[model samples]
Target: METVKLGIATEYIPGRVNVGLYVSDNGARLIDSGLDDEAGRKIARMLEERKIPLQRIVTTHSNADHCGGNAFLRKRTGCSVAATKLESVVIENPFLEPLVLWSAFPFGELENKFLQAKPSEVDLIIENSGIVDESGLEAVPLPGHFLDMIGVRTPDDVLFVADSVFSEELIEKYAVMFVLDVGAALETLDRLIRAEAAWFVPSHAPASENIVPLAEANRKGLLRVSEAVLESCGEPASREKILQGIAGRFSLSMSVSEYVLNSAAVGAHLSWLRKRGQVAPVVEKGVLLWRKTR
Candidate 1:
């Protein structure tokens, strides 16, 4: 066995989920399992090399890439899984609307195939600003990507920022960033920037010594998109119209599957904006119209 190690498991080519295994005198703990059985097996192999017994698996959030390996790892090591309370339900029931699922570009069928939520329960439901009592790790509340999203910090000041920010290549290639709550997402970025972390390790991308610049860029991009939505409507527009306008404006060349995923991402953002009082929606003629509230 290699002992405890920090490994980067690439879920998509050039896109990775960072897994950290903590081996100590007592047991071993894993932070952010990768996206499937294969990924889990790889991590297990690494652990076996280190001769460490896996004891706990903690996720920064419930996104598929972050938690998909949960079941496989749990079955292998019998480690208890834990996540923030807000994401437990969604993680357990990963279904998205069919339309939204199809809207996702490139990998549309992935929504149908992989969007099925895995059956894993959170052994520990972390409250807001709660600490995860695992070896050399701290779980901090970081809600933006998802309602119950969190960041795991190591004693060395390595903060595992899960989908909070992405590499420049990912941004350019994906064109559209998936955010459930734009406002909250920005706020969370601000929080992370202000925190005292030496390295920002994103689950789906490489770590950066300084993430503030990228975070700022992403924030501006989101604000620009929001402004575009407001301008296209001229007046308050329905949620559907706003989404359509966004797609048109971005010139997104999406297949049916991509379209569904994109729709879900837009819907999630709109819902977040509504919750934050940044936007308001009115039902008109059996359709929902959304407008900037503030």
Candidate 2:
């Protein structure tokens, strides 16, 4: 609802999802939009009240909570949307968000706004050039939390870190944050650990000048989840049993949505372990089972 100024031209509206604002002589560019039409409209109104024109929306990824407001903002402000290749596909399709999570044609239950954001056109396809072309904002490749996620750096030195890391409280509360690639997430953490920025803003966590403690916490949280998977599968286990066991271990009570997301995170950990030859998967009586190889 309120914008916190980070620099002369950069301000971020922090809430359930943080929306970054960067201004220049031409117009304003939103780093990422929040959940839906409501969120988008709120942002539009705030900008309009300040006599600011929204020229573009650079989404970090295709996650609904992050880019869900794109459609509404684009329609209302006629702003061009920009995102990386894979995320652009899901952003334009929208349905793919819930589809991938549901692993097929998603059912009605999984079609909620939190999972399926309204489709928005992508006017620009960002590459790995670091510089996001016309805008000149540096797009740092932040792979792992989602496909082709990037952290946008304004000239002022504030980095909109997107979802590469979770708040320490979230890690303790949820026990497992959804990750598309555990390996990539770990690597991203390393990058954050060594990153130099005047300020780093995680979409979910508060912005900080020193992000090492938070980055280290994320590294440990990821490893803790990976270790839990290894220990749970010491005797071979199906992905479903593994997920449920981890949830039980963390005393987590999940809805259908949370179940699907956490299930995906567990799968990512399995993939990471398999890639390192730390775990092996076998089919037993038609049920796929994973066991720690070493």
Cα-based lDDT for every prediction? 0.68, 0.91
Candidate 2 lDDT, tens digit per residue, 79-145? 9999999999999998898788878988998998999999899999997448885666889999898
Collision pairs in model 2: none
Model 1 root mean square deviation, Cα atoms: 4.7
Q: What's each prediction's TM-score?
A: 0.81, 0.98
User: What local lDDT does model 1 show for residue 234?
Assistant: 60
Q: How displaced is residue 189 in candidate 1, in Å? A: 1.2
lDDT score of residue 163 within candidate 2? 95
The sequence of per-residue lDDT tens digits that candidate 1 reaches over residues 1-294 is 222223332121123667655555677777777777777888888677758787888777766777778888888888888777767765666553232345333343565434553667778776656467746577877766666788777666667777788766666665567776777788888987787776677766666778888888777776776666656446778756777788788776776556655666677666666676777787879887877775
Q: How high is the lDDT of residue 170 in model 1? A: 67
Q: What is the lDDT for 79 in model 1?
A: 85
In model 2, state the lDDT of residue 26: 89
User: How many Å off is the CA of 179 in candidate 1?
Assistant: 2.0
